[model samples]
Target: MTKPSSTDRPNPLQVACSSCNLRELCLPVGFSGSELERLDGMVATRRSVKRGDALFRSGDAFEAVYAVRTGFFKTQVSSEDGRDQVTGFQMAGELLGLDGIVSDHHTCDAVALEDSQVCVIPYAELEALSREFGELQRQFHKIMSREIVRDQGVMLLLGSMRAEERLAAFLLNLTQRLQARGFSPTSLVLRMTREEIGTYLGLKLETVSRCFSRFQEDGVLEVKLKHIRILDLAALRKMVNSPC
Candidate 1:
């Protein structure tokens, strides 16, 4: 875990209707007036977590579903020796607790890589509101569908792709996801450590480090400690498609 930075302070209350970036992503499409108010009312609070902060642990009692307002995070599982293996990375506007929606116990641990803010919506309240409104139910279904698709994509990345390609694909996916949430797609501040990234991609820490060097050499990206900027996304796309 890295040391805390200045932007890692806790978040204040969030009213979705007032946030332009959240209008479409958090609220249902064409949601207006009273419907939006009902949706907004479900948000219990907004909280901030610094890099290296844990949102919840595996097997913890699940109380709320967090919708990321900004920044990135990872969902991880622990091995028998208590080492973490990252299962997924989440961009802004993505829901982080869907896997536990039915189980009521977290399926994995979620940790913020960057100083991030997430809207904590009580699951019970959301369920109650969703039951009464067909539109809300439809919207909830769509969100779940997206989450499922994203998970499938990750499975493909991890199960089939080569080491460097897996790493590149992960970066490309992260950029696009963040871009949808109104963040820069080309330049990003990495939140995950090299070791953490290796765990997520099923690569060795040294291989992950060498892959960064290869990217820099190939003019695909530049990495300096914490900051990463994708210099040639097209090149990266090609690398991700390259045969091992």
Candidate 2:
């Protein structure tokens, strides 16, 4: 990907973590002004990715971890049979590129599900800053732990959950994350397509569509193409928590 032009960069003061609205979600809590400035300095640039483009691909050198300043992304890895398997979806205020920390190269492709911008935090500089700030180090560790936990949850979804249950859990997770970012808990426009959701949830495209229809028939959701409104949140939660 080409570097963003100098003119496209946001003013440092504007993008500084100290004043960023996402600071509470993206940064460790209770950092002093000085610490926030230092952390902000680690993010020296912002990159814009257009819809349908990849921010990073498998085998690319990992130089930094990106913070999604806006929009959404999906990370996927190719299977042995050459099919792309969607691993996870990431949204604004979330971090990406952690997959490369152990190997120094990205193992999956991070593609924009919509037009997106990310704060580029150079990993080396971030490491230095984290060393000086104990809270930053702890927060970084917590982020990694969360990724692990999410992966385990995906495993459970694929291994045992029925198609309806898998889709219900996926919607619940997506809505919860969006709600954390101040979005309505019941309404959303899905950034990824039904096919992509099927790929992520390990369901066939037709099966995914059928499950949506079933949910609508059962008064659980109001579906209008990409727009989804949960008409019965309690029913979805019940489906997810139902005995296997």
Best lDDT among the predictions, by candidate number: 2
Per-residue lDDT for 9-36 in model 1, tens only? 4445455544536667774567877787
Global CA lDDT computed for model 2: 0.90
What TM-scores do the predictions have?
0.86, 0.94
Candidate 2 contains a number of clashing pairs equal to 0
Off by over 4 Å in 2: 1-13
Relative to the true structure, candidate 2 reaches a TM of: 0.94
lDDT of 1 at 62: 86
Cα lDDT listed for each candidate:
0.80, 0.90
